[model samples]
Each structure stands twice: as C-alpha cells, then as structure tokens.
Target: MKVRELREHAKELDFTPQEQVRWLAPRQLARTAVKAVLAAVFAGYSDKREVQEVLDADLLEAPCGQPDAREIWIDYVADVGDGFDATSSVAWTLAEEELLVPRAIEGTDASPAVGDLRLRRGSLLVLGGDEVYPAASATAYEDRMKGPYRAALPKAADPPLMVALPGNHDWYDGLTAFLRMFTQQRPIGGWQTRQTRSYFCVRLPERWWLVGLDSQLGSYFDDPQLRYFEKHLSANLEPGDGVIVCSAEPTWLESVETNADAFNALHWFDRNMIRTRAVPGSKRRVPTHASVRLWLTGDHHHYARYAERLPGDPPGTGVPAPDSRRRQMVTSGMGGAYLAATHRLPAVLPLPPPGSRLREKDPPVAFARMGRTYPDAEESRRLARGIAVPWSGRWLPWRNLGFAKLAAGLHAGLFLLLCFLFALAEGVLRPVDAVRRAGLDDFWGFGAVCLGVAAALFVLGFLGRLLRRILRRLRRRRGAAPPSGPEVATARTALPPSGPAVATLSQALVALAALAITVAIPFPPSWDGWLVLLLCLALAAFLGAFVGSGVFALWVLSAKGGQVAEWQMSGQSIEDHKGFLRLRIAPGGDLTLYPLVLKTICRDWELRDEPSGGKRPVPTGKPAVRLIEDPVVISRGA
Candidate 1:
C-alpha cells in the first residue's frame, strides 16, 4: 500500500437510499464490536507457538546497543524502503498514529479485555502481510504505531507459532531488505536478509497444519499464489487436523470482480474447495486431509469476516452459524494502515455478513463535458475509481502544499504536468508530437519493458566488443593467433576475433528511417510519426544474434581468451574462478560452446554438430566416448 497523509477530520458519510432508511437501524453497537475485536487479536496472539529469533550479539550492537541493554535484540521493527515522496510521505503521515505494529496484545479496561480469545486447539501466529506502513526504510516500526495499549499485555500470554508471508509492500525494492532484519540467516554485518519466501506449513501440537502463502509474487510473477496452491495443497491436507490459509490481499476483495469478473474467482479463499486433494503431509505419512477448513487474511485494512457457500463445499460453520462456518475469511490487517471505507454502490445491498460493508472508500465520479449545442457543463462520465478515496459525502481540497494540498486535479492533474513540459519543449524549438498516433507511444506499457530488454542487450554487446578487442591486442603482444570466431574457445590459442566495426550502426539506421518518414508524407496529427518499435526490434535482434553470440560464448567455460588462460589447465587452484564458456560434449564427441550470463547464449560461429536423441552408433565398452580438452596440463593448473 502506498501512503496518503491528510488530517482525519470528522465528516458525515453520504446517505445511500438504504443507509438513509437504515441510519436509525442502530449503529449496531459498532464501537463496542470493534473494540472487542482489537482486544482479541492483541491479547490472544501470544497463545500460539511462534518463537522469536535470538540474534547474534554483534548484529544489533552497532545500531541500538546501550551499555546496560541486553545483547539479544528481539521486538523492534525494521523498515527498508526509499525515503519520502508522494507515496512515502503519505505512508509516514498516516502511519505516525494508528493501528497494529506488533504491539503487545493485552486486555483493555473498557470491553472484552485483550486476554479473552483462544486459538483453535493449536494454531500458529501467522503474519500474512505488510506489517509496516508505506514500507519506507526511514519509517521505523515505531514511527507510525499505537502499541503501548498492547504493550500492557502481560508476559503470561502464550505466543502463536510464527509463520510469516511477505507482501508486495514488505518487498519494497526486493525482499532481501525486510528478510535481512527478521526472517533470514544474517551474518554479523550482512547487508540484506538472506531468507526464502517459499510457502511454509506449520505443524500444530494437535494434528492441525497451517499453510502460509507468500503472495508477494503477485507483483513479480503472474498467478504466483494460484500456482503455489496448485503445487502443494494436492499433497498437504490432513483428515483429522484442520487447515488454515493465511495471506495478504484477501481473496474476497476480488469480490467486486473487475476485468473477467467472478465475485471471488481470483481469491484463493474463493477457490480453496477446488484446490485441496487427498495427500499426506511431507513428514507425517498419514492420509491427513483431502480438503481444507479455513482461510484468514489481511491487507484490506479493515475487519472483514466473509461467509460463503460454494456449490459443493461441506458445511463447517461452527454451530450457531452452521450454514456459514465451513468457509471463514477474516481481514485482521487492522494491524496498521490509514483506514478508508468503501462507497455503497447504488444498486447493491450489503453483501451480508461474514461479508461486511467496510473498506477504503471508492474512487471519484467523473463528469463528461456537454457539447457546444447544450449548456456549458459536464455530466454522465464513465469513471473508474482508485485505491483510496474520500468518504462518500466528502470532497478533499486539492492543493499544492507538501503537507495537505494535492497539486493536481481529480485526474487531469498528473498528465497536464507532462503536457505543460512538452509545450515548453516545442515552444523552445518546433512542434513535435512524438507521442501521437504513429509513434511508439501507440503501444501500451509494453514499450517500457521492451526498451529495458533492449538496453540490457546493448550493454552486453558493448562490453563483449571491448573484451574481444583487449584479447586481440593481447594475442598480438604474445605473438599468438588473434582471438576469433564467437568469443574465446579452447582454440582461442590459435584464433582471434574482430569486434563489430560500427558502434552507432543501429542508431544511425533508426535516424535515417525517422528522417525519411518525417519528410515523405503529411500524416494525421493523431498518428505518432515513428517506426522505432519495429526498427528497434530488428536492431536488437541483430545484436542478439551476432554481437550477442560472441559475448555469450566467452563466459560458459573457465577459459581465458587469446593468450590469457581462463582456467587452471589442470589444478584445483581454480576454485574461485567462474566458468565463462559452456562445454557441451555430444554422444559422438562433438563439442559445442555457449556464453553464460543471466542465461546461456550460443556463439554463432562455433555451433557444435551433435547427435539427435535417436540411437547413435557406438561401441559397448568403457562408456564408448573419449572427450578431452586441448593441452591437458598438470594438476596444479587445473
């Protein structure tokens, strides 16, 4: 979640036709109910069996150590994110004073008291979330929290089993940052946390097994959670024991289905009954379970307890609520976040509990401008809302000050800034509509991704050319054969190569095409006049095929280029060296070479002809093939 910090002022919510009718339906003792909940999570969280990490004496010494402080560092939270900005600023302001932050879970004098709830026989304390606000490293765990209330919870409380799943926010830039502070194995002075966010199955003292899914992948890989569920649930459920799935981004919110539309199709909670198949636990070899029992989540920063009856799910709703117990969904994310409420959509009734009517408010209602023939006004616009918004009846002032004002308008704001900058650019020079119809701007965001790929390829080409030249010069100095033929191979001792002669060739080709297109015809202003999309692809491919190939071939094997010997000829002294070139020996003893980087790349000039999968003619003795390197040297040089 990004940050949004404006002072919270009291304003009445807009009354929906139903709300107007239900206003006197009694505030349902909402204040009392909410307090009851806050108390439960705070006090009861400890009854679970989660063991806090005992850090090395040196790890925390440099930062928080005081002469009398204990060497073992435990509870403080660590946030690693880029410092303040619009997003970070919001996170900081909102974070400074509310919600959950691993604060002690004790009882309050007002209501159900903190120490009231109990776990289901045995349960793990699961943190399926982005526990801190804004995720900025500068915002320490304490910067935006109200924990003293929970700190009052006594030590007699039992802690739940600790099973944590990282969220998109937890992974500010990359996951290693948060992992370094909490979950991973860190040396005394390691920079980032070295932990794996793989799914974890926690075993309960009873027979329960709780699975924590790391949904952080939603930002990295498509369908990450779905894929993980598919892979493990088929084999992880147990019969006598119950199953609990905890994740950030509760599946239910997929409730108001956008795009393809299925109320909860994308939420795993919505799909659980379909995922669990009969399988034994990895360690306990028992016919544990074929179906799961519960789903708990946080991320939608309010309390949401949803109940649903999928067509075939068995009823597991505990007693009083027999019809809704089997499938329980809870969003305890009230842990910490600036709270927002959802707009009551016009035609919809409250989805009914355990599905509640609370969440961040809906987006704005845009107005379309009336044509010239009519009154000068705007109305009836089709608008899509954003993540957070003002309560239905409220309107926030859009100002430009750093603290409370928003410089832009409801929507035109972000883009007008760009248009203004462009006008300046053209005013200082000539009109240029590069972003019009025919230019690369016509493509969706894909342009940015493709450009990144092209940049990486170009850099590789540049470095390969540089290294190849260096090797060629070295061979000349050693009175050896110049390096040649797609990077350096074992044969490099007898061969050398010539790097690409034209460095600006691709750019030049693009420039000529753009020049021709600009002068040849008068196209529509809507048409962005440019062909860099296709042109860039062609050049990038050329680079990958030719220049890229040589660069790839040089790193697959641990061998030097030209007169330089990359690997120890035959000795163990080469332990620290990396293999730059790949050595492939086919069934017929033909060898192939490839270069190694993020992935393997084949050299165009050094293709090794190999036998296919079909049978190969061979003698049935001594493994039949003798593969050898050139000039096998002494053990010391291996």
Candidate 2:
C-alpha cells in the first residue's frame, strides 16, 4: 500500500480503540498512584473472593478436559491489553488458523527434535494476567483488550475456551470488571470465557492440569480460594500426575524489594498444597509424589525460563537429565505491554530464597536459565538506550507532550515556591508586621489551619511507619521473614546496602543536584531578578520534560532497580519484540511449548472485505514471526 493510501486506510479503519498508556503523563501517574494506594488499603475489606463465595460463584469444574483426553493444544499470553500495535499483533497471530514454521527444531538431549512443526491455533486460550494496561475498568477492558481481540477474530464455529488469572492491574478495581467480563459466560471474539471466578483450574489430558491462581495484588489468598483449590486439586491429584501452575506475577524471579508477599505465597502454596497435600484441617498430611511440572507467569512482560538444573549438568546447557521431575519456571508476559529488560535476570535462582522461612527446613534447590532471552540480553540493552533519547525523532515535543507539560508545570510551581522561601529568608516580611498589613481578623485561625495540615501530614507518616512495624511483628509471629519492600538498607542497618540501594542513592543525589542547580543560580532577587526567574523557570521546565527522562534512562542503563526500570520503560510504548506461547499436550502427556515471537509488528493494514461481506483489517505486510527457542518439551515421568 502507498503511504497516502495507508494513512487513509488507517484513518478509516478505526483500528485502535484506545491509545497506548502514557505512563509518564501527570494525570495518569497521579491516577495510578491513587488507585494503587486505595487498592492496597481496601483490598482486604472488599475481598472479592468472599463475595464470590457468598454468592456461590465457585464454578470449579474438573480440569478442562477428560482424563483420557491427553492430546490438546493451549495458547498462553500475558501482560496484554496495551498499545493497539502490539496487542493487535498478538491477537492477530492467535486468531490465525495455523502458522508456518520458520526453522527446523534441532533436537536436544532433554527434548527430541520434531522438525517442520506446523503451529496451529489452540482449543484453549489462557490469558496469564494484566489483561489490560494502566487500570482495570469496564471501558478500559473493552477498549484496550476486547476491541482488538474481537476485531482479530469476530466469530468461530468451534470457538476456543478462554480463561484468565488476575494480575495487579486487574485487581485495581477489586476484580469487579474482570469478573464481569471473563466470568459472564460471554465471548471475546472467537474465544469463550467459562471461568466463574478470577482463579481457575483446567484438567488437561493424561492426568495433566493447568491451574491459574488469583494472588489478589500479591497479597494473601483468601480462605474461600484455598478451600476451592483444596476441594478440586488435593482431592483429585494422583501420584505421578503433572501440573502446570500459572500466576499473574513471576514472584520467583522478583526480589524481596519488589514482591515479597507474592514470593512467599507462591512458595507456601507449592509446599503445603502441591507437595505435602496438606490443608487447613488435614489429619495426616503425606508428601505427594505428584509434582508441579511447570510454573508459568506473565507480569514481567518478557520470555525467560528458569529450568531446574540436573544433578550434574552445567548451567545454560540444553541437556535434560534422565527421569528428571524437575520443573521449568517460565515468564512469557510479552503479550502486548511495554517490553521489560531480561538483561538483569540472574543466571541462577535459589528457590524458597536463601534466608526466607520456607528455606529454613528444606534442602537447597536451584534453577539455571535455559536459553537466551527472547530478544536476547544484548538486544534488550540496545532497546533500553531508547529511553535516554526518547524524543529524538518526532514532531515538536513528540508523544511525550503531556509528560513535558507536567514537568514544566511542576518546575514552574517549585520555582515560585522557592522564590517565596528566598523572600522570607531575606526578611521581606516581619511576622507581626505582615499579619498587621494583611489586616486579617482570623490570622490565628489561619495559623491553626496551617498547623493542622502539618500535623496531619506528620501523623500520616508516623502511621505508615507504625503499620510497617506491626506487619513485621505479625510476620515474625507467623514464623515468616520480614518483607523488604518498603525497608531501606543503610549504614544504620545490619545488612549492607545492596545494588538497588546504591542505585537509588545515586539517582537521589543526581536529582538533588539538579534541583540545587536549578534554584541556587537564580537566588537573591535583584534589579535583573525577573530575567533570572524566567531563565530558571525555563530551565526547570526543560529539565522536567527532557532531562527527567534522561535520569530515567540512567536508571535503565544501570539495570539495578526493577521498579525504577519498569517506571522508565512504561513510557516507551514499545511496539516490537512481542510474543506469546503455543503449548501442545501430546497423547502420552508430554508437553511442548513453542515461544513464538514477532520481531516487528504489522502496521500497514488495509480494510479488506471478508467472506461474509463485512470489512476487517488485513495487514499489507505479514508479521515477522519467529521462534524464540527450540520447542521446550517436559515429558510425563514414568
């Protein structure tokens, strides 16, 4: 298609229902912060699981298929519902009847080679988590997620079943919209939703199972959910059965600073529920031979697998151990969200964590990274550089105009405030004289109000600290380790400052210096003070808009703080290097995973007439689809 034709076609297509989330936008930032705080505060009080239980909404059916129905195909995607380009690309790919294999499947010692594999659409579609971006709302879900997917495949004669796990974003609205959309027995495009709650279990063929857990913003699992799982899982699981567990976040990979609660919950579930077959009131709990064969998640927005290391095998090698019941922990969150960096993933992961309560009694177990990252670490590093100069090519201030304006406004406000402080410092007003000149009959009242505001702020800070202390004490009582998320390691603490702490300190120092330089130079109002003020304001705005992103880039480059990197990259709205998983269960209960990736998304779309005489988007360019790695095979042990 010609450029003009493409532009016209795009305009007429209405291809995108919602634009990608501008994470750095001031309003979006504030809204997200408020939502986060409110969600955390009221998650327990407004527990949706309790409501579901009260309503008897538990639709826990036997895992998806029959015991003998061993062979099946399942598609897994996570962290979806962001930009139209990326989300649509994934939806389009999943909607296709079949995909042509690009390369031969070279055999490995662990997995046999099945060359010339033709990838077909799965009967079951599993959305790992974060199905929508920014926050969860009915409109947001319809626009960002359902719209693109519906356009991709409006209908199917034998539609695939769809299920989803709720991520942090999905829980922003307490799963109100999520449950309504997914559990209403409605259809999203050609995919059908049958899950009655946020969490679900699918029984695949040959005693294999797929369990999607709703961690509820990485907080504690409710009693109802635990009971539901026990009723279905513990009662039915047999010896030597293989299970696949899916969660919204890759808690195994997250550091204590990022998701300690999630990590603890996952390990606890794995141990008590899966391993020991223990429940709240089990009389005699015996360690079950049934094992969790694979652990899957999607909050990280990338493809990374931490495969259990064989007894004597070297790390990063593709060799599989004989009779190995070792599990593979994979993160395939690249459904449609902004890409996360894989360069920072550690080579080795010690399960249950080194010093956690879970590890205190168990033997050490480790997982070595299996293959290179989907985009590769080097490619991720290169992509990360884009954050440094996010506005290099574009019209005017580019798509970051909102962020720029926010920065500029904040800078101007700060400059004005600093000027007032400077004036006060220079004795521009004696307190008594100022009060008299202002001619306020309610001066004392105004003072009281100001003092009250200050006191309120002080109380809030104190309460926050007190809450943390109480939580820590509660954890100790429960024989759990203290969470490290809000705790800062300093010289005063017994533990030394870690890499993230160092990076945070450096970032803070840089920010302070920038603030000092912006205000210090324009000090002491003189005859030419207005010019100085204008220059300072202009500089401050420029810094907020342009240089603020540079600081973010610095954090990304350092690759130390996961949260910091996430904040910076969320603004990138990346369109390429998107992917999903195509999993197949063979007749013999062997599971094969194909990590399919599209390096470049199809952008030039044409409005084409379909078989039914309706119009839909047909990409002028075919998506560049390729395999992230050779198919990963986990065999059903004897």
Candidate 3:
C-alpha cells in the first residue's frame, strides 16, 4: 500500500462508533445508491448493442511483425481504476511501476526495488475489463486511466501493443469514451493500438488466436458481433488452432437465483463461436475451430482458476487433454477494486462436463490450497462471535446478542414514542367510554397494558434472530448446507417471494386482521369500538414499517461486504488478495501463467509449479529489440 492510502485507511479506522453509525454509514450508503441509480438510468437510455461499424470491422493489426523467436509477453489486468479510492489508486500505480515497466539497464549497479518484475518491449498489454470506475465519462477516463498510465508508463522508444474490452462500467455512457480511447487509431506512449470495434481477434505466432467478446450490460452478444465471430472462424480459423477467449464478465458465476439461467451467455459463446465445427460432406460453411484452449474473464473482483481433472491423468498436469483442452476457466478480476469475500461459496458450481475426447489433468495445487481472506473477514468473524456490532462503517450483518439487544432497544424506543403520541390525541378527543368506564381511575392500568404490549413486541423481534440461528445450527448438524450468512436471518424474517400485487394484498389482509381482532375484544358496538379498531390498524402499520425498515437495513449492511456475482463461478480461490495473470506464450504454443499480486509492496508475484503438464522452457537472455511500423492486415473471403 502507498503511504497516502495507508494514511487514509488509518483515518477511516479512527472513526468513533457513534460517528460511523450517525454519519459515515449513511453518507456511504447514499453515495453508493445514487451512483447505482444514475448508472442504471443511463444504461437504459443507451444503445443496447455494439456499434455497426465495430461489428463489421476487421481484426486490429499490430505495428510490429511476429517475433523471430516466436515468443510473446502479455500483461493482463482487469477492473483497473485510475484512482477511485486511495488504496486502489496506489495499488494501480504500484502495478504499473513494478510489473508494467521493463527492467532497468543491466550492470548499472541500481538496487532492485521491492516487487519489481518488469515487462519487455514489444509485449502485448490486454486490459481484461473495467478500465475506469464511478462512471465511464470522458473526464473520468482521462483522470483515472490516461493520466495514470502516462505518468507510470512513459512513452517508450519501442512500446508494446495495447488492446482492451469494454466492461459493464464502461458501457454506462454507451461506450462513447471507450470507443474514442481504444477504437480510434492512437498511440499511448510508444505503444500503438488500432481497434475499430469493442471486440477483436488477434492472430499470434504458432497458429494461436486471441478472441475477445463484448458481453455488454445485458450479458448477451449483439447480432453483428456474433456474425463477425462466425465469419472469422469460418475463414481464418483452423480446427487445431490454439485459442484463448476473453469475456467482459464471468457470467458463468451468476447464481441461478440472480441470473435464472446459469452460464447462459458463456454457453452460447462456447457453442456458437469456440465449439462449432465444419459440417462434413456438406456445402454449407461453418466455423472450423472445434474448441478454445482457455477462457479468461473478470468482473468478480478476485482471482481463481478451475481446470477439469481427467481420470487417470497425472496429479499436476496443467495441460488439458486435447479433447477437453478448452475446459479451463480462469477468473482474474482482482485488478483493482474493493476485495470480495471468498467464503460460503457453493460447493458444486454448475458447468458443462468435459467432452469425451478431451483429457483432464489434476487441478493446480495453488487452487487446491488457496485460503479465504478479505478486507472484512476479521470483522465478519468478530460479528459472528458477538464481539462487535454493526457500527464500524463495514455493514456486515449483526449475528450475535449485541445486535439483538440493539434492535430490541430501537423497537422499544419507537413503540414508546408512538404510544405517547396516541395518548396525547386520546386526551384531546375525550372519548365518552374513557369517562363512563371507571373514568381516569383506570388510566394507570391502561398505560401499563400498552407498555407491556410494546415490551412483548420488542422481545418477539429479538426471538426471530435467535430462531434463525437455531435453524442454521440444526442444518449444519444434519450435514445440510445452510444459506449464506447474510441471507440466513433476513430470509427467515422476510415475506415469501411474491409479486407486487400479491404483496400489497397480503399487507391489506394483515391490517384487516388486526382491526378484526381489536373489534372482537368485548367492546360495545359504538363509535368507541370503531375508533379502537382504527387505532389498532394504524399501530399495526407503524410497527410493520418499523420492523420492515430495520430488516432492510440489516440486509443492506450484509450486502456491503459479502461475495460478488463472480463468486459463484470461483471453483476455488487461490488466495484472498487482488491480482492479475501474466501469460507467456511460447513459440510451440505452450503457455505459462504467473499470478501477480497488485496490492503488495514486496514480493508481489507468485509462480506456481503445479499443473506441470504443457510447461514451457522460460526464456533466458534478452533479444534484439526494434520498432517497425507494419501495415494493417485485413483478411477477406476470396
């Protein structure tokens, strides 16, 4: 972490309990809600498809020719922010200073800095998704993206080729800024990028192809984009060509409850683009590539890798069997954003089975041994243990006695306030029954009964939390999986799933029920009885809204720190930190992955030795570097 970010974090930690609850929590919630509303409204008004020109465009050509050694260095990062937050900005700067730069001149006697692993000249820089945050406006792009990159990565004499894909955040303004920055033929520093569309295909040496798709706001590909892929695959792609696919977000991770159709977009892309093959003995044309070798995605704000394990395969073979080679799914979304939790994920994720012809190897040891940790893990543990409450500006659900006591106190206070107001109104109205039946003599008793009712209601509210905990414990004891921690208590207290109309009808029925019970209390059929029933209905509505709002607040707090949409697809977490993948494509089409930690000040990179199959020899010495302005190559159907 940078010094400034550390200072900012320290300031946040210095907030008092009262200040956090009274000010910070409300401020953060309001800001987040406003941004969400604006983004949603803008997306609704924007075009829902890729631009026609982009869809019809050809693959972007690099300024330099294929390397003589057939080796390429690619730096892949996703969800990178310019400096949205102090911590994220510092992390992004450090990544550019350390991992994005080339090593200093040799034999200069300059000391090596911590976490210094540089990229070579003429390498390819691929931004997986979400280049900016808050909004995708031109000003935001300039402040958060262009300015930072220009400072950290100065114009090199021979710059690498740059390419990027649009994420949901980038589409907030309908890709206006993203298109201008990436699609327009331009050079950042010495690196040149020529992209005419949001999605593109790049042909590397050794018949390896990189295909990036634009899965925009709706998680669906546009018709033109789909057709472009179909045409490209049918013409240039060969059946045995090694392929790597880049998707904007890991739609495969969206849960059934949220997405309804698990892996819908991914399945479509795989079936239509990557898995399609030519029809034998037919005149109709079709895609030639049978499958892709790797699928890369982001938008979950964490890093995870899952590979199919074939029967009788070697324990650490990272290489996929030819038939199932395209089964590897890697998520590297932790480029720069608030870290997401990795615990409480579903045990078995829904995914397509490996093809019969494909061979699987053992999963990577790093994935097997990855631990779950996040920014709020400690707070969650404390909350679960009753050591803390929900007043830290960290909005995790309150699970213990402290939360119950706090909630009960709040309800009791509100109930007392409402009763006082009702009594004041009754005293002014001077109802005849009050004077006829024992007059003011029973005033103390009536007040006592009302107070008792409030006390009982407060106690009942606390019992709901207790019941939920008991149920969770029972489920665990029976070896049955429990719901997510944040959802467990709320789901128990929440109304059953219903449409808006049904929900309104249910509320009306509840009010009528309260009124009926009040009228049945042996009171005479007079104006007094009707007034009492009306009062009962009013009290019920007040209490209902109060309890409902409290529950909603708790739900909001729980959501603030839990897992994101991508957690469902994380087969296993490698570690609980932000990072991206550094891919090295060898001349023989073999691939090696180096997971680099983005937030670390020292020892930022991890090179796993497991999944040992398809391991390529690491390069030893530097090669002669040169800059060439190659012409754009447009392949057309003959």
TM-scores for all candidates: the values are 0.33, 0.77, 0.57
The lDDT of model 3 is: 0.48
Candidates in descending lDDT order: 2, 3, 1
Write model 1 residue lDDT over 188-216, tens digit each, in one string: 11121222343454433223335665544
lDDT of 2 by residue, 1-638 (tens): 43235334444444435556777667888999999899999999998887776544443333244444647888999999987767888899999888886664222234434555688898889999999989999978876899779879889877888999899998899889999889888999788888788888777777787889987887777888887788777667788888899988878766333332337787778776777676447577887677888889998878898878766675543534433356788999999988877776666666665556666666656776766577678877766666666554421125456866765575566545544543454355432222123223333343344446545765666677679878879879889555332121111132222434444444333333343564334243342545565666677667655665455445555544445556545656676779999998887778888988888887666677656654566667668677788778887652
Clashing pairs in 3: 82-144, 310-360, 318-611, 323-357, 323-358, 324-358
**lDDT for position 269 in model 1:** 36
Clashing pairs in 2: 63-202, 63-203, 64-203
Which one wins by TM-score: 1 or 2?
2
lDDT of model 3 at position 253:
45
Every candidate's lDDT: 0.29, 0.70, 0.48
lDDT of 1 at 14: 10
Model 1 TM-score relative to the real fold: 0.33
Candidate 1's C-alpha runs over 4 A off are 1-124, 136-161, 185-198, 217-236, 261-289, 310-325, 342-638
- Writing each residue's lDDT as its tens digit, candidate 3 over 1-638 gives 33233334322322111110111123333654575566567764665454554434776433346444476766677876623232233333333423343233222345544543454433677788888764587766665566445433445555677888988778767788888888876875445676678888877665667888887665567787877776665356666677778988765444322342435666666665665644546755466545566768877665555454445555542433333332456677766554444443332232421111111322111112122222234532333222122353333223222333433344434433433443453563423233223223344455455556655755665577678878879878889443343211121222322223333333333333332333234455465645653554455555444443334333333332223222112211112245556666666666655554533312121111224221111112212211111111111110
